[model samples]
Target: MPGRSHSGGVIRRLAPLALMPAGAFAVHQLRYWLAFAGRTGLLLQQQGHAYLHSVVPWIVLLAAIAVGVFLQALGRAFGGQCSLPRQTVSFGALWLICAASLVAIYIAQEFLEGLFVTGHPAGLAGIFGYGGWWSIPAAAAVGLVLAVSFHGAHRVLHAVADRRARPAVRVRGPARARAPRHVPAPALAPLADGWSGRGPPR
Candidate 1:
């Protein structure tokens, strides 16, 4: 596991994130069903009912994982095994991107679910009960345009950053132009008795 990488197992790796919520749901439902299976109803009488709301995000979590896995697979299968960005984004930008992506995926999911039966199946789609078709296409178009704009801005800013990172010519005043002067060393003092009191011997 020390040198392991997620790339080696694409779909196999995504399985956990994508299936966790479903698995949790299955277990939760199974517990309830089993509780009703007997007259005791011990499982249903269990506490922690307050935490039931916590499971609501499982669908959204699954959707986010699905989107990430799909994109990663797409990049690898054709885009040369692309990996996630190692750099961080601004807090606001990150929040906005995450919220927007989840909304998009949720909408698309609802649309797909509307098309097929109440069961599971591979698919794709979008939905809009109000504002007609205009709103649907408009949302998609706006998202696309924003994505393009963000990419362009990122590239331009990246180039500007690279340019500014290079060493620059810093001008200094005349007073500070010369190199620093060194301090003079202290002179040696006269020797005591032996050398000072007598002359040198042959």
Candidate 2:
């Protein structure tokens, strides 16, 4: 055991990957709560909040990861690194997609709330429209943050994968050539005198 150590524990190493998304989700929800506490308090208190909470946020996270991968792909397309213009374009595309998706999801949720639940989030109706200028921008902001988060997650996952694939022992120097073994010469019976093939013994 002298020259040996191992990253034997599987779950321990992967703890970061599992924890990162949870942490990001917590921060995302907390940020929203803090920002909208004054106005959207009643909407947040509604029973249908469960339906909204369970589904939409996860969709946002999926979008973020997809956007991040797209951005990374753009980066690779340009000189194996992300150019500033390409990054800007990717972020812009992400923002558009994110903002539109949020508004659309909110509208659909509101429609469903109207149908099933009692009073709907009438306030959220103006989200990204007239009174709620902050709606799209806010969603885009979250998208950006989550994009960066998932990008980091992507990197961490890849690094873990690489680490797993790599050989445990790293040899620094060239492998030593095996020395030839000193095997003894094979024994043989003694030859009789004049034992030639062409002539018999005199």
* Best-performing candidate as measured by TM-score: 2
Candidate 2: TM-score? 0.38
Score every model by TM-score. Answer: 0.26, 0.38
Model 2, 68-135: lDDT tens digits are 55545444433333211212335456545544555455455445655677544444452323233444
Measured on C-alpha atoms, candidate 1 has an lDDT of 0.45
In model 2, the Cα lDDT at residue 78 comes to: 39
> How does each model score on lDDT?
0.45, 0.47
Give the per-residue lDDT of model 1 (tens digit) for 116-173.
5343232432233321233334334434444444444344444444455556789876
